[model samples]
Target: MIEHTALVVGGTSGIGLATARLLQQRGATVHVVGRTERKLDPELIPHWADGGDPAQIAAVVAKAGPIDWLVVSLSGGEGAGPIAGLDVATLRRAFDAKFWAHLTTVRAALPHLTPTGSITLIGAISARAAMPGTAGLAAINGAVEALVKPLAAELAPIRVNGVSPGLVDTPWWSGFPAEARAAYFAQMAERLPTRRVATAEDVAEVVALAATNPNLTATVIEADGGARLAALV
Candidate 1:
C-alpha cells in the first residue's frame, strides 16, 4: 500500500477541493493551500496564501513538510474578450495567477518532494481545442503542458503530469450572467459525448489516478468527455 502526504494548492474550491477530499479518502494526508482560510473542513489544514505570491507559496511549502504529491490547480483571472477591448493589465494578471503561480509552487516544492513523489498540474481543454475569446487560457494551459514533458525528465523519479479538463460544473460560473452560463452549458452538453459537462468528481478521479499510477509520467490526461473528439467532427 502506498501512503504519502499531499499538498494541494488552490484546494478550497472546485476541482482542487474535490481532489483533496479524494486523496484523503485514498489514505493520503492532504493539506490544502488557498488564499482564504474559510470554507474548508475542520480536518483540513488550511494555509492562507495568494497563489500569485511566490513568497507566500514558499512559506506554505515549508510548513507543509515533506510532500509526496503536489497538485497545482491555480485558476486564471478571467475569460476571453475581444482582443482590442482586452485590458493589458487583465491579461498580465491572468498569467501571473495561473502560469506564474504554477511556477512558484513547483520551484518551492521541488526540494521538498520525496523520492518517487509526483506533481500534477491542472490544464483545461482549451489548451487543445480552440475556443472563441479564450486565447489567454489556451496559451497558458498549453504552456503548462509543454513544460510537463521536459520537467518530468529533469525531475526524474519524481513524476510530473497534467490533466486537461473540459467544462466541469463548478461554482466559478456563478459570476457569469445566468443566460450566458446556461447557453455555455447547453453547448457543452450537446457537443460532448457524455451529453453533459464534467463534474468536480470526474476531474478528482483523474487527479487521483495521476497521483497513484506509477507507470504514468509526463502524460496529459484529457478529461473532456470526448469534447476533443466532437471538435474534430
Candidate 2:
C-alpha cells in the first residue's frame, strides 16, 4: 500500500537517511539526493547534488518523475552565538541552505508530484522555541514554517506539511568532539521533558506519518522532546 516513488533531498545522512530507509521498509521505492552519497542507504537510488543549487535541484527532480512524496530535509548550521556578534557570511549560508534552497526544490518538484502527492519539509524546534545563540536558525526555520500553510492552501490537493525536531543527535554535530557533544546532549536531556535527545529515526517516523496521512496538511508537527515547552519556562 505504501508503493510509490519518493525523492528525499538531503537523504545522505541523519534524518534524511533515516526517512529514506523508512520509506523503503514501508514498500516505497526511494531516490536519495544529496551532496555526499557516501552515507546513503544502500537500498536507495542515489543522486548527488549540492542541495543549495537550484539548477542541480531542477536537474535531479527532473529525473525522479511521478513522485508521490517530496521530503526536503536540506539544512546548514551556522554556529550558534549572540545576535550582535553574528557573522554575515554564516547568516547568509544558513538562509541559503535552510530557506531559499527549500523554495527552489519545492518549485522544481511541484510539477512532477502525483495528484495525491504530499510534501514534508524538515523544520526545527528553533522556529517556535527561542534559545540563546540560535537566532539564525530561528529566523530560517520560522520562515519555512510560515510558508507551509500558504503552500498547502495554494497547492490544494497536493498536501504540504512540516516536521520540526529538537536537539537531534546526528552527524551535524560531527564538528564537536565526542565528549563535548555528550555534555551538550546531557545538558539538553535535563531540560527536555522526554529527558533524552531525539534520534534521526525518531524524526523520520513522523515524516512518514505526515507524508502518508491524507488529511494532515498545512501543519507543522513538533518531533522535539518537548523543547518548545522548556523555552516557555
User: Model 2's lDDT to the true fold?
Assistant: 0.89
TM-score of each: 0.94, 0.96
Superposed on all Cα atoms, the candidates' RMSDs to the truth, in angstroms, are: 1.8, 1.5
Runs of candidate 1 exceeding 4 Å displacement: 178-180, 231-233
lDDT of 2 by residue, 159-194 (tens): 999999988999999999999999988987998899
Candidate 1 yields a Cα-based lDDT of: 0.86
Q: Write the per-residue lDDT of candidate 1 for residues 134-171, one digit (tens) a residue.
A: 77778878887887899999999999999999889887
lDDT of each: 0.86, 0.89
Single out the weakest 10-residue window by summed lDDT for candidate 2: 34-43
